[model samples]
Target chain A: MSTLTSHRTRPPAQPETLRARRLPAYAAPAIAVAALALAAAIVYGAGIGGPVLVIVLGALLYLVGLFAAANAVEGRRAARNRTWSALIHSAFVLAVLPLVSVVWTLVSKGAQRLDADFFLTSMNNIGARDPNGGAYHAIIGTLEQVGIAVLITVPLGLLCAIYIVEYGRGKFAFAIRFFVDVMTGIPSIVSGLFVLAFWVLIVSPWFNDGRPSFSGFAAALALAVLMLPTIVRSTEEMLRLVPAPLREGAYALGVPKWKTILRVVLPTALPGIVTGVMLSIARAAGETAPVLLIAGGGAAINFNPFENNQSSLSLYVYQQAGSASKYAPDRAWTAALTLVALVLILTIAAKLLARRNRLSR
Target chain B: MGETPHRSADAGTGGTRVTQSHEWPAGASARVAEAPVSTRSPDGSGLGGGGALPRARAFGAERAFHGLTLAAGTTVLVIIVAIAIFLIAKAIPALRANTASFWTFEGWFPNDNPPTFGIGALAFGTVLTAVLALVMAVPVAMGIALYLSHYAPRRLGNALGFLIDLLAAVPSVVFGLWGRDYLIGPVTDFSGWLNKYFGWIPIFGGDGPYGNSILLGSLVLAIMVLPIITSLTREVFLQTPTANEEAALALGATRWEMLRTAVLPYGRPGIIAAVMLGLGRALGETIALALTLGATYSISFNLLESGGNTIAANIANRFAEANDTGRGALIASGLVLFAITLIVNIIARAIIYRRREFTESAA
Candidate 1:
């Protein structure tokens, strides 16, 4: 008892100290600046590079400097950690460069033709020398094609999701799910080819009196095929997220299974479903190959989707970019910008709606 | 532990009650007459209520809904089968008409009399460009993914991740446009520099006129697939067990060492899956390659030369002016692309599914 008391009464021992050494916080920034100076001197003074080269060389120098300095100061392991950290950060920066350039180029070049004339008029009568053509018809075509695709895909996809989530069992359901995954990876261009073969080559020829004529409706068919898997997968996820307790509660209230799913599950998952639908729509709208293949892109303003050829913004961009005329590139840029804007708007709105969805949380 | 015997006893009683109800009269009216008595009691209640409940009257509606949904699900399968069948049906005629050795020939002249065309060059370019793009993209994508998942602060990571997702949402056609007009100059200059510096290497040994080359197309493809790989790998990295990470850190391992010891080993399958998925995308990319590649037809290995073509790009470029035979030939090429991507995706899915069991067990 005396020994225990003496030990308990002894003063607290000194805290153990860590032997690991760390560099100062500002060391990184200082080395970065030094590396930049060295790289600038080597690249610019030699007249062999530009800003991009300087940045690249500077990043290399910084990595080397960081490793050397950290190794001398903080030892090998810390040096490796620091080097890897710098590399990872620079990797992100390197990726951001192309993305930023893409966006900046679109805005700068696309803004040149962002005018009322470019928006309101069709490219029907625009000559090779004319700079006043617009994607009015293409915009209309994209909307109609995408709108029709949405109308076809949403119900089918929703029902498929319902089937998979609520009623699915055993191998048939597994096959459906597996194929859906496969279908999701089907190339957009291949989807276009499918439609071109099935619809434009075979089915639409019946409607066109033995001649295979392209129509906006054909484009809609291709887009529908592309949009189906995306919608089904997303809606399936959303449906799965609808809690089991909710279904159990509905069942406890004597609601039939179908009614429970229709009244309870669908309502709970609706916002998420809409978000998925909108996302698929955005993806479908940006498709160029299918529209290029089956729609037989027209410059004229033909509003009838089932009757005649129609242009889409993507198709228009592709067309204008390939055209020999000098004015076409500007039009291509503007149309590309328009298509991107449309897609981005839809995607953003869908994301926002998804965020608001209770089921998502 | 206390409830187990009680629950099992209740289940046994319930099973006996279900058997007793099955022994009841088969008539609906009789079952309905029996429902109230069984429902009123605490024991054996709801056993007869199974078939006699009002909800049973809606069975027809339930079956109809189920059938409808089942039909919708089946349509997905039908669509895939139809794609393969229709593509073959169209391609057969074109294949039969080909006079040239379709496997070895490099030129595409399906429009000519007797129609000589081949997928040799296109397939070569497709695989080459896609492989090269993956080579360029995978390391950097992994780096960015690691940064997002482990390196960056949480809020910064979230914001940057959102930005990367938005980058993915940017359309392919827009990327094509940018690559054609804006990126071409820099890529051309870079190509020249590579040719000048690395001219001794056969692949880099090229003369002038080096803008729309395999290098340019692969660069654009790399950019396009970077976000996909990064996002996927980031998710995988984020899922690294905190216990494993802490174990490594507790061993006095530095961050990089911890990643190498803990995170990477666990995330290898996921990384491969992501890379293969990216490869799939790069293989099937259309407009971007169409706009960027020089559209040449040869099995060239020169990365700095302005000569490369892919199956999808060739289809997109030639589909507009293709005749019956030409369209069929292009569709044939599309068939080849479809098969390639299918294999890639199947392998990716297999990897994911294999890993899924491990992860599920681990969790």
Candidate 2:
């Protein structure tokens, strides 16, 4: 009642003059359409070529036209606002064009070879003139290589997260955290180089005769190097998000910290951890450089990752595209599409799972 | 204690607990076997509510788990150091055998008997293309970020943001394929159009062949980097205080003025960080430029000519064919690329770190 009385007793104040007045909302679109039409006509009449020219002229005209029209009707402040708004909107449109174009191009070009034959056979013996071949070997290589990478990375990543979250203290923990971040900034090619120098040049050669050898396991090792930081970062976030009280409760009951984390924490954060792992897998799968450097791209099927060279989808795409054959481009496009599809599927699933976890929690 | 009432219900275990604690020295087991008293029930919420974990817990099991986790954590440091050491060990021989200045020469002939090579052209191309990419991408990314944060409806902004993130996830190799195959024609025409109109400008001065230019490579890189900058700047913009916005609104400031005064200033550091991160990505980008560029090794500023090469692209293009010295020179170049990226990433990290106080408090 008192609050109502206070509100009723308040006096209405005089309004002050403001410099800028907002133009009617429809003014923007009207000006944009008129400017675009004029730009299109002028370009067409002048015999100017390319959609880039048309789009650029149209956008420039729209900004000038909107500012002028608004200035005439309102004032300079409003005109400036109109110009900024137009520019912002045009910037968005420009940024979106390449994304739309890339996807459309991929789908149109890739759909040509996304057939059973594309998946069922290998390019082992396919001639430059021949149109029939598949990424069977490459697909097998990708799966085996990525599987090995995951196997090596996940355990290491989980343990690191467990240490950081459960037992790490002060400088040791901070050093670990800082370096993990630094590790993420290492270029994928550099990781490949590191593996090329260390694994293929030194370690794998030990297993074989003394001569350097490139193999899928070396590629997997490089991928694992790329993947570890990503997994650690994601697992760290998930572990951190596991409520502290759960740990305190477990500790109170004389549950050893490791058992508490294993039985209580990991289960709660598992969905998020899995999502992170999936994303890392997606990133690792798309890498061409690491595989090219160490895996040593091959044409035929090679299931043994520990021994000779193998091919991955990305390596295959690079190889086929570089082959300078007419049909090679088709094979390249299909392999790229397949890699993209797989990565996108994993990414989407991971994102959806993350969203579900957020909502459920 | 709250667990006292439940203790009688589990008296059968209570007898076993006395023997367990007696068998093991109380001090030796740390907090594990010592917690059967009043500690478990002090805070009242025990979801597990089990008879205090048996005497077998802690000690050996705890030490082993911590050791394993610590080892994993330590591996990150080990790997980074190992990479540097190995790169140096491989690159030193090539550096020593160089008959020419390794820093300034334009050509790469490391496979020759005397091994004459330099990273000047490749390094210059790397920085130039990355800078060009940032020039094209940063403004547009900022615009899209502003649109998402300020102009678009909530649902539309979210959908568009998701689409942009999807674009980021598209593999670089895919972008390379698209650029080399599909984007080449349009780029060729655009190059001609620019040269015809802006021929007086040195960058747009090239005549004759126009496709596979630095402009094309940079444009492709711009497209690749767009999402990262957009998403980051959007997050920073969204972090602007609501009170600050409302104050500007109450003062009858226009939307643009409000954003200029409040949001942009607040997001400046974040934007710089985002752009630098994008630059890092563009700098080290390999396959996309490898396929898009004409694979020349010169230091020209021309954006219309069919010529450009980055260190990463060169490595990818020539590594397979490279002899021992050639591979060593490539590793040397890789070291340079690594240093550049490390500097960029560290600076970006420092920028973000400067605002950590505000963020932590706000959270």
Give the clashing pairs for model 1.
Answer: none
Best by DockQ: 2
Model 2, A74-157: lDDT tens digits are 888878877898789889988888888999988888899989999989888888889899999999999999999999999999
Interface RMSD for candidates 1 onward, in order? 6.0, 6.0
TM-score to native of every candidate shown: 0.89, 0.88
lDDT of 2 by residue, B1-363 (tens): 111122222433444342222323333365444444433344544334335444432345666787899999999889988999999999999999889988899989999999999999999999999999999999999999999999999999988887777677888999988889888998898788889888999989978598898999999999999988898899889889899888987897889998898889878778877887788789888999999998787899998999989999999998988999999999999999888887888777767776676656764
DockQ of each: 0.48, 0.50
Top model number, lDDT: 1
